[model samples]
Every structure is written in structure tokens, then in C-alpha cells.
Target: MRRLVDRLRYLGPAAGFLSLLRLTAAAWAGDAPKGEVMKHRFETSRIFPGTVRDYWVYVPSQYDPARPACLYVNQDGIQYDAPAVFDRLIAEKAMPVTIGVFVMPGRVEAPSPGALDRFNRSYEYDGLGDGYARFLLEELLPVVETLRTADGRPIRLSKDGNDRAIGGSSSGAACAFTAAWERPDSFRRVFSAIGTYVGLRGANAYPTLVRKVEPKPLRIFLQDGSNDLNIFGGDWWMANQEMERALAFAGYEVHHAWGAGGHDHRHADVVFPDAMRWLWKDWPAPVKAGAGSPQLQAILIPGEDWQLVGDGYRFTEGPAVTAAGEVFFNDPGAGKSYRIGPDGEPAVFLEDSSGADGQAFGPDGRLVSALAKTGQVVARDVSGSQPPRILAEGFPPNDLVVRHDGGVYVTSPAADPREPGKVWYIGPSGGKRVVDSGLRFPNGVTLSPDQSLLYVADTRSHWVYSYQVQPDGGLAHKQKYFHLHAPDTADDAGADGLRADREGRVYVATRMGIQVCDQAGRVNAIIPTPNGKVSNLTFGGPAFDVLHATCGDRVYRRRVRARGANAYDAPIKPAPPRL
Candidate 1:
């Protein structure tokens, strides 16, 4: 009884509130311009799988068949009196002629009468990844374009991200932000009300990630209440504030509206009209990515984005640079090797690469490789004057590094999951020994700037193990030093190739992107690749300041501020890490 009275007091006579939402646009504008509303059902979601959902599309009366209309997507099948608000705004020339999409959460039907249906609201909305974004871009939005208006006018939405906006309340609001965060190229504006930015589905990491990742080109308006929910997931009010603070800290263009109400949509509904104006104030002007944290600014140069160096390969990996700064990479699936010189053009260097997965230059000016198919580590001169010399021939090394002192270390994953991975060291004089063993899947291997420590990426877990390099070419005191972030759908970080810079920052190729960590073993920044997949990276180009990444079937390069620390060169002790 008290709850009902509090709600009545807060919302004030439900009938009047309903009347306020249903009022004709003629109250504000001279005429009430109406739009065509159509409802449909969608069940073919490969991303969410076994989920069926209903959605509605609103085509404004002013829509033209030739010009593509702007877009607004709302969750929970539309709220905040959007149709009337859109009519008033469009009639007054405040917002653009936009096509609106209102969708509901998905549900999977139960096979038996005794079982309850599976609801996908929390799974799709509260989680973080490219899944929901891909669903909208690949599945839902595409199906929307196939529909038509009442008069048979085709619905055409602008492909430009600047012309799109997404909004919702509660979990839907979180989904709106996640979609834009993952793909700024698709949706760049967000309207979040009472967002569930808590630990319901790993959304608690957003505050930390926003402060660490390079900022995307997005403009967001957040709305929450002072008396929101304080459940086991997290404090809604505090999480929204943390999000606002983190966005501001990373230099994002964001706005917020706080109320004294609880976890309901009443406050958000009252402020809905104004939020639209603020979100679309500057029409046609593109939202630009902001200057990121100091850590990101140090590595990513201004106006230097990822540039494609090569493509259409089977699979590119094992990028290494010669002393003169020429870059070389192998396509093991194609059984070929390629080289890129100062001209920035790639050419076939070796006709046959012996199916090598990782390679590095040695102090002796010889290029050494870890051949996966033949289970051998071989070294050869670029001149091809001498045949390849086998350094080791038993374990199949996934990655290897050669130090300035002629020390070679390689990571070899076990043949079975029941066994542990091994790290091997081949001395300068030639015999190889198992320096260390016990990692789940020891992959990419590299040495510190001073060659005093060795780093190896354990792909089966979210850890990059570090070891003290002993004088006798053996590892000692191994520790799970560098922590990494995994995707919401995966348990491991998918850490692969790794390399250290002269500044003692380690760049790791991961599923979540390139996680750059400081010497203290803390991830300071995340730089995602063009295609969102990276296998390996190395410093190359004329000045050795260019970063070349092997991304699946493509290769990309970018100029940066930091210099790569080549293990084959003389070591220099870096400044001590900040505690």
C-alpha cells in the first residue's frame, strides 16, 4: 500500500501522465504531423541464436524516397512518447527526418510445456562485446531496409554513422552504449536512461576500460536518479556516475541528467524531449574521436591511423624487422614469405617459408624462424647464399626470440591439454635445454629492453608470465605478471604475440585488441586493430618507429611516438618502474 502511494505521489495521477504523452503535436506546433507505424516479427538471429523478437518501424510523413533518412533506434518497443516528440521536433525543424526503429528483447520458446521460455534481455543487453552491435548492423538493420511505407515508398536510412542515434532505459540503455562503444562506425550517438552499467554481465568493466582504451567517436547523454537500485550487481546511481566521470576523464563528449527519483522511467520520460535536442544539436557534423589518455597519446601519433600494407593472404603472422628497418612477415598457410622495404610495397621474398609461424633476427644478422610443420627452429641469411641451419628439431615452437648475446628462446605448447607447455633455450654454442615448463599454452616470447627478463604469453589464460633471465640461459622465479582483459564470451584473454618497446611498455596482441602494459605489469591502454584481430606485431619502417601488425588475412602499419626495442641489438637498462 505504501509502495503504491509512493508511486502515485511520484508519478502524479497516472491518467494525466498518460494524457501528457498522448497529446497531439498540434499543442506545440501549428499542425500535428503524423507518421506511419508498422510492426513486424524477427526470428532469424544467428548472433543471439534461438531468439525471436518483435520490432516496429516509424516512417515520418516527410520522408522522401530519394534522400536517405536519418535513424533513431529505441529499445523496449519505444518509450518516452517518442512518436509525438518526433512529430513535434520534425515539424518544428529541430531534428532531422529520421526513421525510428523500436525493438523488444528476444525470447526463446520452451520445447516442453513444463519449461519456461528463455529470456535474452540480460544476455544481449548487459554483456559487452561485438555481438549485439553485429546483430543490429548485420541482421536487424538490414531487414529494416527491406520494408516500405504505406504508400509503397522504400525506407532508406543513411549509412553515415553521424546520422544514427540509439537510446533505451535500464538494460536496454546499457545495450545502446555497448553498441556504440563497440562500433562507432555504425552508431555514434547514445541516449541512456537508468542504465544497468553494473556487474550483471561484466558491464562493471566499462568504467575501467573507458579510462584505458582509445576514445571512440561518440556523443552520449546519460540519465539516472539519485535513488536508483543498489542490488547485488552494483549500485546503479554510482555506476552511472563512474561512467560519466570515466568518459570525461578520457575526453569524450558526454552529457548527463540526474534526478531524485528511483529506478523507474518517469524522470527519464519527462526529460526525453530536451535530451533529443541536445543529442542532435549539430546536424550533419561528424562526431570525432577525442584525444585519449596520456598513455595512448604517447604511442599513437596524431593523424596516424592503421594503414593497410597488404591483404588477400591466407594468414599473415611472424612480423620481424631487419637491422636496416626492412620488415618481413610469413604466410604459413600459403607456405610463403614476404618483405616490405622503405617503398611501403610488399614483394615475395622467399618462395617457400618452411611453414614458419614466428621469426626474429639474430645478433649474427641471420633470420631465425620457428617452423611449425617441420617441428624445427632454423636460421638463414636473407641473401639465400646458405641453406637453413637447424637450431632445434624436436619441439614445435609456436614463437621464438633471439637476444643480442646469441641466446634463443622459444615457446612450445603441449601436444595435449593434459600436459603443460614448455619454454626452451638454445645456447650460443648450440645445445638446447628445457629452461621452463608448466604454462598452459606458452606462445609469443620476447626479452626485456635490458635482456634481464623474459616475457611469454600464456594463450590459455589471461596472464603473460614473466621470468628472471639467469646467466646460464635458464629462467628463474616465474610469475604471472601482466594481467589482460578477456571478452565477455570467452574465459581467456586470447593473448598471442608480444613485443616490448624501448620505454618498457609491452604490446600484446589479444582478442580484445592490442593491450599495452607498463613495466609494472598493468594494462594502461587498449588499441584495437582495423579488423579486430591481431596475431603479431613488430617495429619496422625507416626510422623503426612504425608499428606493423599481422591481422588475420591482412597486414597494417602505423607510425607511433615510441621506438621498438630490438632484442638483437645491444641492451639498455630502462628506468625503474613506478611502484
Candidate 2:
């Protein structure tokens, strides 16, 4: 009877909306054992200040406080009659003994009667980044943990991501996916119904991102209908199809159901129970990340995660790798530089680094560093046998690179935000000049594999400019070549240190992680650091096949498949890029 009613919901908006209540009431009529629904309000949120919202906690009868139970989080309060569904599923052992958290979108009250209240549904649920996830993990979940159910029973949830799941409909569905996408370490399962995976809040990029970024350990169940929304935002049905295809192309564990109904929860209500069965099949067994697209697989090695090389630094950056596999990085705030050699242990290399912000190995077997505070670029032998030689002075260089011909290029960010930053080139004949100046704040500079092109990251924008390297090492034909993705929290990409691989791929360390762009300049993959902060990275290891990144207070390294194409080495033209 419930399924028949839901199937007929597409008669019209007024009729469909009316039919939904019947489904809800029917959910409450089942003879299945039930759980307690505790309603609560959250008025304090630092992430989305002044916003207040209500949330409900569904504590299953089978949940035991002694053992932490699995968790399921849903947005836009409760839908699909989830509590009754959970009651039946738990009793039948079709799913784990899980606790469900149903939350409404936030609303900020107007200061006075004349102003309208600020609604946070679209702002919170449709935007990309870790904001919503942080709100849940750092704010809401903690507050819920403090609550006590009847009979003094406590609400204890499992901390393992494998034990957690998130789901919702429409924009809320997009929110659920974003939360899991940004923090796969905290939630590994997603259920998206009539998802707003369209241009709303940049979510349309997910189809492309799902194929480019390193795959996360996630399993998803998507539900949508052919007759769903097709308005200014986008076609929900087509977007869902793209998502399903993208997931399959990337080898993700994905399941879906198609129907002829319109944009509503009707179709989902009918398939909700079966979706849960498929989602939680093989309970306690972990969901796994995938062998990504060939592009990503060509760079990342399976079973190899980022390993901490060193920590306890004030701020680390400017990773430089020597030919013999030694890696060196600087702590600018601490005014120190360190080296990791054959023993794989970091040791102090230079106690007085003169505020080195970026460094690279020179063609002459020397280390060239850009001293940000001292306004100098200096070269020192890796063996520490000679005094440092000043390559250039009187310019605040944030990062620099040493070319194979003994030439040097430095990025000098303008002290004033109103003025554009400048790129400095120091010739092999010992002359320095400003090559070009236009980027908002040029921070990281590198050369192409063939050494015929230069790439510079604008720290204040989403562009990584590319220029043709002229005969005299001057730059020409500048264009915003590499387009990067910025975090929702920031105005720009915050693009920093840059590197190129032997395969002609450019890696730009940004706030969103390592945005890897192919020769044609489109981002092909995003590799995030373990700490979600990567200032700079360089290919190192004995074969130049390991990636080392300086991630603010910690340095991490991961073995990969590509060899570093150093500006200091002989130029070898890479194969043409895939268009």
C-alpha cells in the first residue's frame, strides 16, 4: 500500500506533497519494534555563526552503550521514515545496530523585525569544502555525545570511518557527499537521493573530480528518477547518471535505482530498505578505496600512504632533493634547515638558514635557497664545505628555481596587495632583472620538462600562469594555464610551491591539496596530504620516484610512480599530452 502510494506521487506537486505525509504516518503504523527519538536544538556554531537548527537522535533499542555502535547521519531532518526503517533493519539483522542523527538546515534569526532571517540550507548544504563536515564532527557530534537518554543510557558512537555513514536528499544529499568526500577518514558511506550534483555551489565538478582525484574509501548508493528536476540549476536525473558513471569509471563501489517519478522522496521511500541492505552488506568489513583512473594509478602506488618524515617544526617548506636521494627542507619561522639522507632520519643541516622559505638543488651540485626575510637568494654546497654564495639580493623572493644552465628564476611577491607580484630572472652571466610582473602574488616557480616553459603559481588567485622561456631566459606569451580548485573557505586557491614530473604533469600545492595538471593545463588529479596542508612538494628518493611534501609543522613522503623532472637536469621532451 505504501509503495503504491509513493509510485503515484508523480501525479502533481500538490498531490505528491500530500502523499508524503501518508508514507510518514504509515511508517509509524508498523508492528516492528521501535527506537527512541530525542529532539534537540543547537544554537551555537562557530563555523556558521548565529545559525540555529534542530536535530533528532534515533537511538535503536539494540544499541548498547558498552559497545560503541555504528552511526548514520542524515540532513534536512528525518525522511523516508528512517527511524521505523532502522527499527526493522536492526531487528532483522539486515544492518548494524546503528544510531541515526537527523538534522535540519540552519537559520540565522534577524537582528530586528524589519530584517528577514538568514537561511543556511543552500549555503551549508550546497557549498563544497570541509565546513559542514567540521560543523558536524567538531560541534554537533560533541554536543550530542554529552546528551543522556532515558534510564541513564549514554550515546556512544564508533570513531572509525568504516563504521559511519551519511545520507540525504536534494542539496542535503550533496552535503552528505561533500562531507564524506572531504573527510573520507571520518565517513566512508554515502546515500544520495535526488542529489543536487549540479552547478549549484560548484558541485557539478564532482563528475570530473571523481575521475581525477585519488579515490577515497567510499561506497555509495544513489537514487534518482528520470522525471526529476530540470530547471535553472540543472537536470537532476542526468547529473545523477553522470555521478554513477563517474563512480564506476573510477572503480568505486556504487549502486543506484532509476524510476519515472519526479523530484521528491517518493522513489527513495520505496527503495530505502533495499538500499540499506546493499549499503551495509557484510557488516564490520571495511569499505576500500579504488584503483583510480589510469592517470592517477600511473602516479600513485597502491598500499603506500603518506609516511611522516619529520615533525615538530615551526613551519616547513622549500623541499629540495639531491641526486643521491637526500631531501632537505627549511623551517622559516625557526630559521633552520634539515636533511634526510641514507639513514632516512632528519638531522639539522643548517642551524642558521636566514629565513629560507624555498630551496632547490642547483645544477652545480649546490643548494640554492630563497631567504624571504633576508631578501636574498643564496647557494651553498650540499656537503656544507663552503660558505654560501649570494646569487641575488635586495628582493623578497618567496620561492625560486635553478635552471640547468646555472640561471635562476625567483618569485617576488609584492608587499602591497594592490600591486601585482614580479618574477625575477638571474642570468648565468651574473645579472638579475625582473622578467615579468602581473600575478597577484607569485609564490612558486618551476620549469617544464623540456625547460622551454615556465610555470608560476599566483598565491592570491586560482591560476598558475605559464610562459614560454625565451632564448635569453626571458618569459613570453603568458597565460593562466593551470586552473586550480579552491576551498570553499578561501577566496583563492592559495597555490604555492610547484613541481613537474617526467611525464609532463605539473603539480601545484594548494589549499585543496596537490592539484596535478597535465601538459594541456587541465587539472587531472588532486592528491591531498595527510594533514590537509601542503605548502610545497618535490620528487625525491633514490630513483626520484618518491614525493616529499612540507605540510606546516610536518614533512611527509610517499613513494609514487613518476620521476622528478628537475630544472637543474638536462631537458628531455616528454610525450605529447592527451588532449
Candidate 3:
């Protein structure tokens, strides 16, 4: 009877919306078994202050309280008689025995009758942040762990992400995705039906973000219909399609089914059973993401492999590209710097590099470096003239960036222990002054294309700080910071090197991968390294679009849509009308 009502509600929606609703109804009904409904409510003071969420747990007869069972989480409360379906599927051995937890969004009750309670649906379900995921893993799941099955089997849940799955519809669908995306190590399988991947609560930015981030080990199943909502937020069907396209572009293990129905759960019901099977098909074997996207493939040559550029060094830092697309990096520990020419050959660029850890090229055809051992900024012309000329003296410079105006800004990490970092400006007249201070382990620094802003990466924290560049070579409003996150990793969010493209995409070399942030300071995508730790990166090639990364002993390259902020952007004068 409930199934029939669900079908009727789905059919009432627009033609395009019916397919999704119908499929959901069928999927749920086909898998559900005949079972009794059970309900339980509990309150805990351990969660966010004054916030209480009502959660429903479904237990099937096939669940043996004598042993632990797999777990599934459904956002937006429980639906489709999940317990019955689990019982049937487990009894027939069609699916693994699992305990289902359906949870409702939290609400903060009003202090008085005149005031209304603050419902957290949109805040918890639609937002593209990790607060909700944190709430679940740290608070909700821990509380659920205290409970036991009817047979007294201590409900021991698997800590492995592969053993966990999350599913939902509409806004709940978005919540499910945000959870898995933010914490892929917690949930690896996702089932989304008629997902609210639109503008509501910043969900619309997901498509673009998906394409930019490094691929994670996640398998997603998406379903939506043409007749879905076409309201102020966005067209649900269109958003889902865009998500599918972005996932494919990023080489994610994504599958989708489109129908001619509307925004309800009917179509999802029909597909739910199959979606479950697909999501959990290989269980412990694990599902792997493809070899990145086409753009990534074009840049990374699979057969070429990562050859040892050089080794036996204390620390390798700073990579810069020349006009010929050759790369030169510093081996600070060995007090030497090597260059990799376009022909993939390594040669000594400078044996006495003055203990250089960070290097870049200035527009005047000279290489600029941060000489940590000498506490100075130096510039050396490639013509192999005399030794490097001191551009500015008296500061423990860590990383340096050269502006088009011939000015230089170098980060000093040893300036103060409490603050530990400061950006110093070196005027074209050879005068030096402190631009800004109070940064935590500032390691990498770069300038925007127009030189309007400077980006600094803090290797000790998970934040990338940005500062506006004043015309007089000073920094302003330096508090703006962007987050760089990875799946349950250590504080290695430490971004070591920074670079930017014409489109304002900032790439920070980080521990888990290269975290890409857009103009708005949001993490758009992540580019993982074949090896985990990446110390630095730079853009090369004739057009300045090929990205080269220095990870431990290996170097990797990739192509991107945006062009690098080359020091020299002017057209070269024709060579004396040769003759």
C-alpha cells in the first residue's frame, strides 16, 4: 500500500520527473521483503550543542545478533521498508547482510513559543562543506555504536571505507555525496537518486570542482529524470548530467541512469536494488579509479615512467622553467642545482648555487634565488657571467617571487619563532623592507598573473594564505586563507610550493596531492602524485601550460587549460631582420 502511494505521488509529478520516481519505487519494492516496522528514538548531549537528530535503525531477520553485519546509511530519514528488503536480499544471498541507519536532519528548538525552531536541513544537507560529515563520523556514528542488535551481537561496524555505503535522494543525495567526497576514507560507495546537485547551498559548484580534484578511490551510482525540478536552484536532471560529465572527465568510477520522470523517489526505487548490487559488487577486492582524465593523460606519459632526476641529497627544493622549457631545481642539502633540458637530460646548471632552496627567473633574463645560507636574495644571469649579484641582503629567505616590475618578494620562515614567517619586498632600487609577517611555516610563494596578489603555502597547516599586492611592493589584507584537505591523512596538508594560471587557478604542492583552488579560495580539485609527497612544481613548455612537479626523487608533468604567469609576456622584437 505504501509502495502504491509512492508510485501515485511519483506519477503526479511532471513527465520528466516520473522516471526517477518510478525507478526508485520499483527498486525499493523489488528488493524489500515482508517484515514488521520497528522504531526507536534516543537523545544524546554529546553532539553539537542544543542540536538533536532523530535516527531510525532497520534490522532484518537475516541479521544474526551472534555476529556483526555490514552497515548502510541513508540520509533524509528512512524510506522504502529497507529492513524488509535487507531481509530478502540477505536470505537469498543476493546481497550481504547489513544494518541500515536512516537519519533525519537536526533541529535546534526555539527558546520561546514566539520564536521558531532552526531547522538544519539546508545547512546539513545542501552545503558543500565537511561539517556534516564530521558531525556524523565524530558524533552520530559513535553514539550509534553503543547500541546492540536484538540478538545481543555487539554491532561491530567495519572501519574500512570499502565496507561502508551511503545513499539518499534529492537534498539527501547531495548530503550523501558531500560526505563521501569530503571523507572518502569513511565511505567509498555512494548511491544518489534525483540528487540536489544544483545551486542550493553551493552544490552547483561540484561539477567544476569534480574535474579539478585528484581522483579518489570512490565508486558512485547516480540516477535522475528529465522532469526533475526546474526552479530557482537549478534543473535537477541537468545538474546530475553535468555531475556525470565532470566525474567522467576526472576519471572517477561513476555510473548513471537517466529516465523520463520527475523529482520524486519512484524511479530510484526501481533502480535502488540494482544500484546496491553495483555499488557493492566486489566488496573486499576494492574499486579503483581510472588512470586520471584525458587532460591529465595528455600531460603524464604513462610509458615514459618517472626516472630519477637525481638523488643522494638532503633536501630538494625550488623548480623553475626557462624559455626552452627546460627545468632547473635546487639540491639545497648538496649545495648544487641541476637542470633537466628539453631532451630529458640532466646537467649541472650551477655547482655553487649559494645554498639555494627556491629558484625563479626574472624578466631581465636572470635567475632569481633565495639563498638561505647567506640570508640574501641573489640574481644570476644565464650567460655564466661572474658569481650571483646580491639583489637584497639581510633576511633568511625561504622562497622568492619576481614581479614584472623587477621587484622581488621573499618569504622568511626563521624571522620569528612564534610567527615563524614573513614576506619581504625587494624594490628595484635594491632596497628591502618587510611586507607582512605572522605566517606559520611559510614555505612556497607565487604571484598571480597580473601580480595583483601573492599566494603563500604553509607547510605546517592545511591552509594556503593569500595577500593582495600593493603597487608599492607591499602586502595588504593578508588574513584570507584557503583550505587544502586530504582523506584522513596526517598534517601533511603542508603545501610546499605554489603556482598559478591565467584563469586564477592556484596549484599548491601538498602531501596527498596537488590541491587546486579557484579565485574564490575554494578547493576545486586535487591532483595526486604517483608518489605521495610533492615538494614543488612549476609550469614550462613554449606556451607555459605544461606543469612539472618534483616529488622526492622523481619529476612529473601534466597539461592544463590555463597558461602560467610567465615573467615575460611581451612579444619579442624581430631579430634585426636577419639576413
The best candidate in terms of lDDT: 2
lDDT of 1 at 9: 38
Each model's TM-score, in the order given?
0.94, 0.94, 0.62
Give the lDDT of residue 258 in candidate 2. 78
Clashing pairs for predicted structure model 1, backbone only: none
What candidate 3 gets wrong by more than 4 Å, as runs, is 1-47, 64-68, 300-391, 394-398, 401-496, 499-507, 510-525, 528-579
Instruction: Give the per-residue lDDT digits (tens) of candidate 3, residues 133-190.
Output: 8887887777677776555655566767777788899999999999898788888889
1-579 per-residue lDDT for model 2 (tens digits): 655655555433323344455445545667667899999999999999999999999999888899998999999999988998899888889899999999999999999999999999999999998999999999999898988788678999999999999999999999999999998889999999899999888899899889988899999999888889999989999999999999999989998877777788888876677678788999799999989898888899999999999999999999999877789999999999999878778899888888998889888889999998789998898777898999889989899998999899999988989998899999987879999998899999999999999999998999999999999989999999999988767999999999999999999999988999999999888998989899999998889999999999999999998899988999989999998
Which 10 consecutive positions of candidate 2 have the poorest summed lDDT?
10-19
In order, the Cα lDDT scores of the candidates are: 0.89, 0.90, 0.75
Tally clashing residue pairs in candidate 2.
0
Model 1 segments beyond 4 Å from truth? 1-30, 110-115
Let me know the TM-score candidate 3 reaches against the reference structure.
Answer: 0.62
